[model samples]
Target chain A: MTGIELRGVEKAYGGNKPVIENLDVQIEEGSFTILLGPSGCGKSTILRMIAGLEKETAGEIFINGIDMRGVSPGAREIAMVFQNYALYPTMTVKENIEFGLKNIKVPKPEREARVGEVIEMVGLTEYMNRKPQHLSGGQRQRVALARAIVKKPKVFLMDEPLSNLDAKLRAQIRTDLIELHRNLGATFVYVTHDQVEAMSMGTDIVLLESGRIRQQGAPESIYSAPKNLFSAQFIGSPPMNIIKAENLEHGGASLPPGTVSLGFRPEKVIVSGEGRAPERGQISFRGELVAREILGDHAIYKFKTAFGCIHTKTMSGSTVEYGKWSVRVDAKYLYYFDEKGDVIK
Target chain B: MRSQSGVFWRTFGKACRLAVNLLIFAVFFVPFYWMFLTAVKNLGQTLRLPPAFWVSAPHWENFGKVFDAIPFFSMLKNNLVMTFGIMICQFFTVIPAAYAFARFKFAGGRFLFGLTLATMMIPAQLVFLPLFLMFSKMGLVNSYASLILPWATSSFAIFMLRQTFKQVPQELIEAAKLDNASEWKIIFKLMLPIAKPTIVTLGLITFILNWNDYFWPFVLTTNNAVRTLPVGITSLNIVDGGVKYHILMAGNVLLVAPALAVFLFAHKQIIKAFTYMGGK
Candidate 1:
C-alpha cells in the first residue's frame, strides 16, 4: 500500500508554463528514491506534488492501488521534511513531533508514546523541551524528521532536508537517514541537487533537468551507464569529460587517423615512462600540466590537449610535473559524445 | 579628572538630548496646559498672556460643576459603549479578512485590499453629512446607534493586520494544512497568536479616536444619553454661559485622561506596531 506509482503526471502554473510534463515513476514500497537535479529543475515540485502540497494539474497518483486524486496530504499518510526544517518555532521538539498526531485526533497517550519513540529515534531526547529557535540547523532538521516519522507515515517526502547543514553534518545525517529508512522500511522520496547524495543514498535515483526526468535506475547502474549527455554530465562529480568525436563506425567511435576526440577519467590515465609512450588498448594525449589539485587520496590533473583541456586524476604520492607531461589513457574508461552531446554508445 | 573638552562635549550632548525630548513633550502638552489654565480662570484671566504657566490654586469643585452642568456620566457611558463596540467588531472582522488577504490567491483580493486602503485617503468630513442624514432617516438618530455603527469597519485595521499575517511563514500554513487543519484553525490557532501586537495597536487607535470623537457623534445624537465625552464637554460651555473656565478645564481633563493613560501603558506596544508597519 505504501508503494507510489505516478502515471503521466503533468503540472503547470495556471494552465501555462508547464513545470513537469508526463512524469512517470514507480517507487518500491520500501525503496529510497532520490530526485536529483539542479535548483529550479522541478525536483522539489515533484516531491511537493507527491506529498499533496501541490495539486496535480493533470495526472494520476496511486499509492498501492488507491487513486490519490481525492486524498488530502494528511489522508495520504505521507510526511515531509522541509529544507528549512519548518519546525514550529513556537513549539518545543516534543510538541512539534506531536502536532500532526494531535491534529489527526490520535489518543493522547498514543500520541505521547509516538512522540517519545520518534524523539529517541532522532536522538533528540535531550532537546525535547527546546523550541526550534534554540536548536542548531542540524538539530532543527532532526526535529523536522522526527515530526514526519512520528506519524509512522506511509511515504516520507524529504525536500533537500540536509542541504542546510554543513558538509560534515550533511554526511553524518546522510548515513543516519539511510539507517533510519532501513529501520522504518517505509518508502522515502528524497529530493536533492547533490549528485553524491543521489549516488550514495538512493536505492533508485531519478535525475531531472528542466522539469523532465533525464534518467532513472538503480544508483550503480546510473553511475556506470548514464542514458544520455545530461545524465552523463550530471551524475558524477568532476563530471564526465564530454569530448566531441569525429566519424566513427559500429563499435564506439572511429578515431580519425590523427586524434579522434577521447574522454577518460583522471584515474584511468597512467603516468607511463618517457620511453614507453601510451600504446594500443589506450588513447594518448600529450600536453603541459595546466593545473594540479592534490586532494587527500587522489590528485586531479588538468591536461592541455589539442582538443581543449582534459581533466584526469592520479593516486596519492604520484606527482606530475607542471607545464609539460605525457599521459597514457585507458581506452576502456573512455566516454564518447557526438557533436550533438549524445552518447555514441 | 577627564579632559575638559571631552567632559564638556559629553555634557553638551546629554543636554541636547534632554532639550530635544523636553521640546517634544512641550509640543504635545502645551495646548492641554493652556486649556487647563483657561478652564480654571474666570473670564478676565482666561486668555491672559504667556498663557497661565501656573494657576494660583487647584479648583477641585470645577469637576463637580462640569458634571452637574451636563449629563456627564451618561455621555461617558455612551462613549465607552460605542468605542468598545467598534473595537470588538474590528477584532472579529479584521483578522479573518486579513488572514485571507495575507495567505490566499483569490482573484480581486489584492484589488479589494487596494480598495480598502484607498478608503484611508477619503476625507471623513465628506461622508459625515450623508451618514448623519442616513442615520436620521433610519430613526437611529439621538441614539447610540448613530455613534457606534459608522466605526465598525476600519480599513487601517485590515491593512495593518494583513501585513502582520503576511510575515507568518508559508511553511507554517502548509504544515497546518498537512495536518488536516481547517482554514479556520490556521487563522485562530496560528495567525492570531502571531498577530497579537498588531491587534492591540489597532484596538488602541480605534479606542482613542472614538473616545475623543466630537463631530459625527455630535451631529448624530442631540441628547446627552447618546453624546460622547468630547461633545459632552462642549455642551458644558453653554450651561456655564461661557464664563466658567474652571469647570471647562475640569471637563477637558476628564475627557483626555483615559486616552493618555491607555497610551502610556501601551506605549511600548504602540512603538513596536509602528516599527512593524514601517518595515512593511
Candidate 2:
C-alpha cells in the first residue's frame, strides 16, 4: 500500500508560472523516501503539500489511502520536523514533546507516560526541564525528533532536519535517524539537497529538477544507471565526467548512432603511466596532467585530454608523475547520451 | 611604551564619555529640581528676588493645599479608569489586528495596514473637534467613556506589535498547526508568550500616554466630575490674579509622581523593547 501519493500536483504563488508542475510520486508504506534536488527545485514545496501546509494548485494528494484534498494538517495524522527544528522556544523539553498530545486532548496519565518514554528514547530525560534555548543544536534536534515521534502519526515528514548540525554530529545523527526509522516501521518522507544524505539514508531516492521528477528508484540503482544526464551528473561527488563522443578517437571501437556525449564516473577510470597499453574491451587516452587534489584517503587528478578535461579518482599512495599520462575506461562502464541529454540504453 | 599609550587613550575616552553623560543628565535634572524646590517654598519666598533655591522653611502643607483646591482623589480615580480601560481595549483590538496583518494573506491586507499606519501621521489636534462633537452628540461628554473610547485602538500599538509578530518564523506557526492547535490557541498560547516583552513594552507606553494626557480630557469634560489629574491641576492656575506658584508646583509634582514611578521600575524593559526594534 502506498503511504502517500501525489497525482499531477501543481503549485503556483499568484502567478502563471507554477513552482511545481505535474509532480506524481508514490511513497511505499514503511519506506524512507527522499525528495532530492538542488535549491529552488520545489522539493520542500512537495513536502509541504503532503503535510497540508501548502495547497496544491492542481490535482490531488492522498495520505494513508484517504484523499487529502480538504484535510487540515492536524487531521491528516502526520508530524513534521522542520529544518530549524522549530521547537517552542519558551517550552521545556518535556512540554515541547507533549504539546501535540495536549492539543489533541490525550488523557493526563497517558500523555505523561508517552512523554516520559519519548524523552528516554531521545536521551533527553535529564534535560526535560530545560527550554530549547538552553539546549545545544544536536539536543534541540533530538527534541524535535522526539516531539514528532511521540505523536506516532501515520506519516513522518522531515525537511532537512540535520542540515543545521556540525559535520561530525550530522553523520552521527544520520545513523540515528536510520535506526529510528527501522525501529518505528513508519513511513518517512524527507527532503534534502545533499546527495550524500539521499544516498546514505534514503531507501528510495526521487531526483527532482525544475519542479519535476527526474528519476525515482533505489539509491544504488539510480547511482549505477541514471536514466538521464542530469541524474548522472547530480548523484555523484566530483560528478560524472562528460566528453563529446565525436571528439573521441574511437580507435576502431564501434560507436552507437546519435551519441552526442559520453559519460563515466571518475572512480571507474584507471590512471597509469604514459607507456601503458589498453587491456581487452578497454578504451585508452593520452592526456596532460593538469592538477591533483589530495582528499585525505583518495585523490582526484584533472587531465586535459583530446576529448576535454576529465577527472579521475585514484589512490593517494600512487606514485604517478605530474606530466603526460594514460587513462583507460572499460567499454561496459561508459554511458551514452543523445543531444537532448536522455541516456541511450 | 605602546601599551602605555593604549592605556592613556582608553582612560581619556572613558573620561570624555563620563563628562558628556553628566552634562546631559544635569540638563534634564535641573527642571525637576526646580519643581521640587518651588513646591516647598512659601508664597513670600517664591516671589523673592533671589528666587529661593532652597526653602528656608519647608512647606509640606502645599501638597495638602492641592487636594483642598481640587477634587484630587476623584480625578485620580478617573485617570486610573481611563488609562486601564484604554490599555485593556488596546490589548484585544491591537493583538488580533496585528496578528492578521502579520500572518494572513487576504484582499487589501497591505492597503488596510497602510491605512492604519497613516493614522499615525495625522496629528491628534486636527481631529479633536470632530471627535468632541461626536461624543457630545452621543451624550458621552463629561463621562469616562468619552476619554477612553477615542483612544481604544492605537495605530502605533498595532504597528509595533505587527512588526514584532512578523519576525516570528513561519515554520513555528506551521509546527503549531500540525500539532492540532486552533488558530486562537496558536495565538494566545504560542505567539503571545514569545512576544511578551514587546507586548509589555507597548502596554507601558499606552498607559503612560493616557496618564499624562491633558488636552483630550480638558476638551471633553466640562466640570471636575470627570476631569483627570492633568486637567484638574489647571484649576490651581488662578488666572488674572496673583499665581500661587508653591501650590501649582506641588500639583505638578503629584501629577508627575505616578508616571515617574512607572518609568523607574520599567525603564529596563522599555530600553530592551527599543533595542529589539533596532535589531530587526
Candidate 3:
C-alpha cells in the first residue's frame, strides 16, 4: 500500500511571504483523501510537493514509507492528472498514453496490451486514433484518465481534474473516479476548493485554511461534529449559521466559560407554521422571512431576526408564507463556539 | 431603388478590388516575366523599342552559354553547400536558444533576450568589412566556412522561434517530464513537431536570403571556384562587347529557379506561421 506523509512542509515563491508553512498531513493508503480549501489556501501547493513537481522549502515527504527528498516526479511511483487534462495536443489519444511506456523501454507487445486495456476502461477505444483537439471535452477528459490509468502507479494525484467539465459531466466523472479508486485500490490525493465535492468524494477529508489544517477526519464525522467555525461553515452547502450568544435563551442552563457564539445547521432548523410555537426546551428566534430559494426537492428560506440573519431549509410543498416567522432547533443540535471560533463541545 | 443602388455599389466594389489585385500581381510578376523573356531573347531583341514582351527567336543556347562564360556548375555547388550549411547549423542553434529563452527565467534572462533582439537591428553591411578582415586573418577568407559560418545562427530566427515556442503551453513540457521523457526527447519529439510551421518558414527565408546574397561572397572570394552563383554571374556581364544583359539574365534564372520551387512547395506552412505569429 502506498501511503504519503508530509512533515513540516513550507513553500515560498522567491523572497516573498510563504504561501504555505509548517503544514503536516498524512494520507492513508487506499483512501481518497481530499485537500479541501478555498483558493490561495495552498492545497494545490501541497499536492505538487507530494508529486515532486514543486520543491518544499522545509520538509520531508515520505511516499510508500520511502523518503522522497530528491526523487524525481517520474520515479515517485505516482501518476498525476492535471486540472486541464494536459493531453499532448499534437499526439493522438493512443500515442499520448503509449508515450510514457515507450520512454521506460516497456516491451512493445506489453505496451500495446496495457494501452488497449486502459483505453477500454475509459471507454475511449473508438477514439484511439483521434487527436485531443478533435475530441469533445468529455472524451478528452476520458483520454486524460486513460493516460494516467495506463501508468498504473502506486499513488494517483488529481488536482481538480473534473473542474473544467460541465456540471452534468462532472457528476458523471465523479462517480467514475469513485469506482476507479475502488478497483485500483491506490491512494488518491485530490485537491479541490468545492466543499460539496470534498464532502461527497473524500473518504478522509483534510480541511485547510490559509496554510494550516483546520480538521481531518471522515466526511460524516466532520459534517456531524465540526471542530471549529471554519469547518462548520466550510462543509455544508449554505453552511452552518453562527449567531452572537448574548440575549439568546439556552434553556436557562449555563453555557461553557468563554462561549460567545451559537451555531446550528440550516437543515436542523424547524420552521414553525400554522402559528404554532416552538417545542419546549428548544432554542427559538423570531424573524421575518427575507428570501426564498426553491430547489427541486427542498427550499431554503432566509430570515432577519433581532439577533442576526439565519436560514432554514425545509422539504418542498410546505406553505411557509412571508412575514413574521419563528424557527427553532433542539438544544442538543446547537453548537457553542468560543470567541476565537473554536467549538465548545 | 435603394436595393438596386446597393447592388450597383457591390459590383463596383468587386471591380475595384479586382483591379487592385491584378495591379499588385503585375507589380510582382513583371520582374519574373521580363527576366525569363530576356533570358530567351537575343542581344538585339533585349534593346528593342517598348522592350519586346515576347521573344521572336528564343535563344535557348544562351542558358548553355552561361556555363562557358563562368564556372557555373562549381558556383552552383558552392551555393547549395553554403545555404544548406547555414540551415542545418541554424536549426540546431535556434531550437535550444529559443527553448531556453521561452521556458526559463534565470537571472539576466530579460536582458539577454533584449540583447538578442538588439542584434537584429544592426545592418549586415556594417559588419561585412570587419568580418572579411577577421576571416582573412584566420586564413578562412576563401573557404566555405567564411561563407556559411557568418550566418550559422540568425538573431531574427531565434527571436521569431522564441515567440512560437512561448505559445506552446508549459503543461505539455511538464507532462512529458512526468512521463519519464528525457529533455532531448521533449525537444525533438514534442517542441519541434509542434513548431513545424514556424521552422519551415524560417527554413524558406534562410534559403532565399542566402541564395540571393552577392555582396558578402563577392568581397570574400576572388574566383568562381569559391563564390556563389549570384557572385559568379558577375563574370558573365563583361562578355562579347559590354554587359550582355541576356546572358546575365540567363544565369539569374538558374540561380533563382530552385528557391522558387521550394517556396511553391512550402508556402502553406509559411502562411500558417505568419498568420499566427505575426499578430503576436
- Give me the candidate number with maximum TM-score: 2
Model 2: how far residue A313 lies from native, Å: 1.8
RMSD of 2: 1.9
Instruction: Please provide TM-scores, in order, for all candidate models, with all chains considered together.
Output: 0.90, 0.96, 0.94
Model 3: per-residue lDDT, tens digit, A1-345? 549999988999999899998888889999999999999889998998998889999988999899999999888888888888889888999999999889999999999999999999998889999999899999988888888889999898999988999999999989999999999999999999988788888999999999899999999999999999999999997889888776564435466778888899999888875356668768777888999988979999898987788988888776678888888888889899998999997
The recovered share of true contacts, given per candidate in order, is 0.46, 0.85, 0.56
What TM-score should be assigned to candidate 2? 0.96
lDDT of each: 0.81, 0.92, 0.89
Error of 2 at A26 (Å): 1.1
Which portions of model 2 show Cα errors greater than 4 Å? A249-253, A319-321, B1-8, B55-57, B239-241
**Which candidate wins on DockQ?**
2
Structure candidate 1, residue pairs in collision: A248-A254, A266-A312, A266-A313, B39-B245, B39-B246
lDDT of 1 by residue, B146-252 (tens): 77788778888888888888888788888777776777776766778668778889899998988898888878877777778899898766762455666777899
Candidate numbers, best lDDT first, in rank order: 2, 3, 1
lDDT tens readout by residue for model 3, B31-85: 9999999999988888778787886779999999899888888899999999999
Mind giving the per-residue lDDT tens digits that candidate 2 earns over B76-95? 99999999999999998999
- How much lDDT does candidate 2 score? 0.92
